[model samples]
Target: MRVTVIGAGAVGGALAALLDRAGHEVSVTARGDHAVALTESGLTLDGGFGAHRAGVAVVARVPADTRLVIVATKANDTAAALAGVDVPSGCPVMVLQNGLGGDELVRSVLPGSPVGVGLALFAASLVGPGRVTVTAAAPLVIGGDARSVAVALPVLRAALPERVDVSADIRGAQWTKLVINQVNALPAITGLSVQQTVADDRLRRVLGAAMAETVAVGAALGVSWQAIGPVDAAALRPLQAPGAEGVAAGEELARMLARGMGDVPNPASMLQSIRRGRVTEVDQINGAVAAAGRAAGVATPVSDAIIALVHEVERTAAFVTPADAATRVSTTQD
Candidate 1:
């Protein structure tokens, strides 16, 4: 497969490198120092996917006869990145990005090209100028035209540890991921590491409130969420083992989460974004939920507050470090 990956940052570099190693002709569209580095040193992918360097054609221009174009840029950069890129009319373009509206944006850019959206459950980052770090290994849930899967799936899975699942109801899956991802912004805002944020009872309560608001909004908008207590409990299920058993255990854990008993850690993506001084996708995450709430006539005060705090941080151009977390919390409270 001839694949071109735009945005040679964390996600793009990681995917492009792995696909290149898999015998696919991979090209990464990056700029400036990153492009130069990728051309010279290849891409260093570390962490769960292991440490390896794979050679890929790094170029500024999109190549002709490209089989697939994967857009892994940030949500804000999607429009600018795809502008003027020449893809075949029927060629598949996969959007591997966070938040909603990414597929629509890609469709608008490519017009006749088949556009698919992927919600990546794993965590990855550009730790250096030419290196990508995979913090967690999770599946990439993709929903789009079936024809697009040919190149997208093989290339993506080759790079990732888990296989990609083509979804029938991608929107539902995206919303499910979004509801869970509401906690990601916590690490950025509170200046806490992944484990530290989830360990705090107060932070977990805050996140639980936000998740409840998103679930409510989803319900109001006619999004049917599966009964997600026991069936969905796999990794977090064993956390509360011992005396409880089977369905009873699942129900009990579900009850605890619903009532804000269990704690959860922040996601690495949001933390990395804030730490690197890049804008957080709070507007597209929690802000999207709040917008849905309004359209569905559901009130989402918790989400609204979360969005507001994140927005303020963005507007002020400030970085919330771990040492300043207490001061920020105190100021926001009063």
Candidate 2:
């Protein structure tokens, strides 16, 4: 399979390397030092998937001979990333990204091609320009139109490690992934790794509150809910329990996510963006939930607060203490 991955950052780069390791032809689009590094030394992946290096074609444009396309860019960058790119005919496009609206955006941009969405249950970090470290490992769950799945599933399943599962209800899978992503904000706000944030008593509760709010929004939208790794719908329903039980369930859900990442110091994607002075997808992540909550007449003070804090960090390039983050969220909840 000739797979061209646009936006060769953490997620894209890792998948490219793995596909190359699987003995498939892989090309990735990258820019600046990252592109130079990939061209010079190949793309390097370590940690969870084990150390692997693949000499993939580093290109600015998608190759005409590309058999499959995967747009692994951030949610905010999805539009610009796909802009002006001509995909090969009959090649299905998979928008493997965080948060929401990525597939629709891609479909709108490339109306000729089939577009699907993927939720990476694994966590990876772009430790450097051309290097990606897998902090956690899980399947890449894919879903969308039936035709796109038929064309892309076998190729992807054969190329990637572990399981490359497909979801019948992609929206529910996306919501499940969004619920998992509630761990992202607190880490970005406090400049802490996910495990550290989960271990903090105050911050843990704050994370629980944010996650609970997200689940409420999903329920309001009538999400059927699919499992993302160990996170099943049943595991999350307790998050809707009243008062203290809900809080504990939410915290437990956070812990379940943390345990999946193992002992590696996973810095979650949002913090990675902040540390690099780049814009984050908080608007699409937490902000998306908040907006939906308002539309559903469900209050999302905690998610709203987290979104504000993430934006503040983006502006100041500074991280707040856990105490400060927790207090701000608590005050809003009050």
Candidate 3:
């Protein structure tokens, strides 16, 4: 299979390397020094999924005969990322991003192509230009329009490690991932690894409130929750209670997810974006929760607070202390 991957950041870089290692013809589009590094030295993969170097075709433009196109850019970059890539009609484009509605965004971009939206359940970071490290290895989930998913699923299963799952309801899977993304906010705020943030009592409590609120939003909207990693509708049942027990359960789940990522100091993708001085996707991840809550007439004060804090960091380019962020999150609940 000839695969063309745009946005050679962490997810894109890891996918390109893995697919190339699986003996597929892989070409990646990247700009700036990252592209230069990939061109000069190839891609380096290490950590959770083992180490390998995949020498793939690196280019600034998509090839005409590309069999598959994978866009792993940040959610906000979805439109711009597809700007110049003239995708072949009917070619499957699997968009891997966080938050909700990724497939719809792509559908609007490449209407003629079969489009499936996806997310890497495992955590892979672009540690450096041309380098990707998988701190946590878990299944990658893909689903959307039937034709698009059919085109992308088998090829992904063959090339990827851990696993590749096809969700009949990608929105449900995304909602589950969205609940888990409660972890991404504090890590971005405190400049801490996910483990470090989960270990803080105040910060953990704040996130717990946010998670419960998110579940409320999902339930109000009647979203069917799918399991992504350790999260599923059943696992989130405790959060429906609206009390300490629910918050505790949410915290425990967050801890389990952090433990799954290992002790490699995963700063998480949002924090990585903050460090790079780029915009974080807190809008799509956390802000999306608040927006849905407003429309559904549910209260999401906690995650809404987190969104404000994330924006503060983006504006000032400085992370907050766990205590300070906790204070704000708790106050919002009050």
The TM-score measured for candidate 3 stands at 0.97
Tens digits of per-residue lDDT for model 1, 201-281: 555545555555566677678774422222232423342332223223333333443334123332456666666677777
- Model 1's number of clashes is 1
Q: Rank the candidates by TM-score, best first.
A: 2, 3, 1
Estimate the TM-score of every prediction: 0.82, 0.97, 0.97
Sort by lDDT, best first: what order? 2, 3, 1
How would you encode candidate 2's per-residue C-alpha lDDT over 179-234 as one tens digit per residue?
A: 99988888889899999999999999998887888888899899998988888899
Which 10-residue window in model 3 sums to the lowest lDDT? 56-65
**For model 3, how does the per-residue alpha-carbon lDDT over 1-334 read when each residue is reduced to its tens digit?**
8999988798888888888888889898887778889999999999777788988888666788898999988888878888877888888888898887666888888889888888788888888888999888888988887887887888888878788888888889899999988888888889999899899999888878888888989999999999887788889988888688888888888888878888888888899899888898898899899999999999888877888899999999888998888888887778
Clashing pairs in 3: none
When 1 and 3 are scored with lDDT, the better candidate is: 3
Error of 1 at 42 (Å): 1.3
Give all candidates' CA lDDT scores. Answer: 0.68, 0.88, 0.86
Q: What CA RMSD would you report for each candidate?
A: 6.0, 1.1, 1.2
Error of 2 at 158 (Å): 1.8
Give stretches of model 1 more than 4 Å off: 226-267, 317-334
- Please give the lDDT score for candidate 2: 0.88
